[model samples]
Target: MTIDFTQQALQVLQIEATAISQLARFVNDDFNKACQLIMDSPGRVIVSGMGKSGHIANKIAATFASTGTPAFFVHPGEASHGDLGMITKDDVVIAISNSGETGEVLTIIPVLKRIGAHLIGMSGNPASTLARLSDVHVCVQVEQEACPLGLAPTASTTATLAMGDAMAVALLNARGFSADDFALSHPGGSLGRRLLLRLEDVMHTGNTIPMVPTTATIKTALLEMSAKGLGMTTVVDKHGVLQGIFTDGDLRRILDQRYDIHDTLITAVMVRNCITAQPQMLAAEALKLMEQRKINGLVIVDQHQHPVGAMNMHDLLKAGVL
Candidate 1:
């Protein structure tokens, strides 16, 4: 007999949807109590479970740790064999079991309690032994299993996972956690580069900067722009202080005005009020300013207002700051 793939998929979706819908009812005072308990914990939150619930517990622990709550996942079976030593008085223990009676998890409860760890029990049964012994019981109960066999933890696991995320995000908001703090834990991601990388790390410096003195002709500025390939040249005084910028846009305007490119001084045709960035500013912030001003490039200056470096939209793009 061939299986009806569409029917099977619809059945799974129906079951999972019902499970998620039922989670709203679980968001009562007890949920707040659980959040409050975890928020008050002074040490790490140790999440432990068995079977599929254990898998979800590990993800929950990771979410908590990345969002500013110190947390980790421990195997209940390992806990019974001396891994319980990792539990400290300054830690909180979260135990997950669909039936609330996983023998392995139950075996470690006494040790966790003895160590003065606060217990948060997540289960489908509110009156189970785990819930009865917990400092806070978070009911992740569902009406039925998404599994056709009604044996695999399906609906209950979905509800449990959502509740775990709710707990983590709530604590994150309450703690005033920032993106910069989150980036520290995820230094390899794009968000980390935006938050931690400074403009000086990517801006063009030395001979790479397109620069010309105020006495230089528009033709001379054009040569500097072409050689540096930045499409613009910074108009500086003899002291190297930036006075203005002559971009391709400025060149177009000058030509339209019939200025003599060979005889006209760059300062006479340059756009005075050019957008600038500080060397110490965050590259991400510079990108934001560029976007807001609708400009394609910026001159980076030192504390003394001397032009030291420059970058354009292409530079930010190449650096992945775009």
Candidate 2:
């Protein structure tokens, strides 16, 4: 007898999808009340559960913490021994259990209550003891498990995770969390680098800036570009004000015209009114601008329009902003 694994896989997907769809109806006043309690709590959200629900609870806690909800997970079994001290009166406890009668979880309810912590219960059975004890009950009820024998927690766990995500996102929106705010908590990730890295952080500054005077000959500009190795040089006036930019492309065009590099003023051959960036501009934003303009380098200028820094595509790539 050959097992049709593909058909079984599709059946499980459909069942889990249906379970998530059914969760829409459960996002009612009780869900809103739960969000309000978590928002109003002075301390962090304490999440606890047992068995497969415990695994889901750990992920829910991580999601909440990353999305600005300030939450952490505690094992129900550990809480009975010594971890219950992690909960405080100012905190909100979110307890998860499919049966709602898990002995380890139920054992600590009285202690949590005695400490004056608010309880939010998530269970598949709404009429279970955990639901009655909770200040707000979120029912993650699903019709059936995606498991073939209806024994393993499949669709039920998916529904619970989706519900947790919904709650975390609702709180995130309510708090007016911005991308920059999210990036703060994820400083070591790529998203954080894109949002937090500034042009000044990666641009070639000080003596490394490729620059030539507006009155300098094209030959002098070429020397500056070569010395800095940025393939371009900014042409500035006597007061250090930006006059224009001359690049290898401009040199190639000038060479095509057979202009004398020794005699031609850089100002006459450079690109006037060139695209520039400020020091505070984001590197990601600068990369977009460069791609849009089909340019390889940018001159960083200050309020006085004086060139302060310079960077090329290689710099952005090295800085991980490419």
Error of 1 at 202 (Å): 0.8
Per-residue lDDT over 1-322 for candidate 1, one digit per residue giving the tens place of the 0 to 100 score = 9777998789888988888878888888888888888888788999999989999999999999999999999999998888898889989899999899999999888888788999999999999999998988899888888787898888888889998998999899999999888989988978888888888998899989999999999889999999999888898888988899988887776667888889988878899878888998988999999899988889999977788899888988887777
| Model 1: lDDT to the true structure | 0.89
lDDT of 2: 0.94
All models, RMSD in angstroms: 1.8, 1.6
Best by the lDDT measure: 2
Tell me the tens digit of each residue's lDDT in model 2 across 1-322: 9887999899999999999999999999999999999999999999999989999999999999999999999999999889998899999999999889888999999999999999999999999999999999999999999998999999999999999999999999999988888889988978889888999999999999998898899999999999999999999899999989999888888777888889989888999999999999999999999999999999999999988899999998888776
Best by TM-score: 2
Worst 10 residues of 1 by lDDT: 249-258
When summed lDDT is taken over every stretch of 10 residues in candidate 2, the lowest stretch is: 251-260
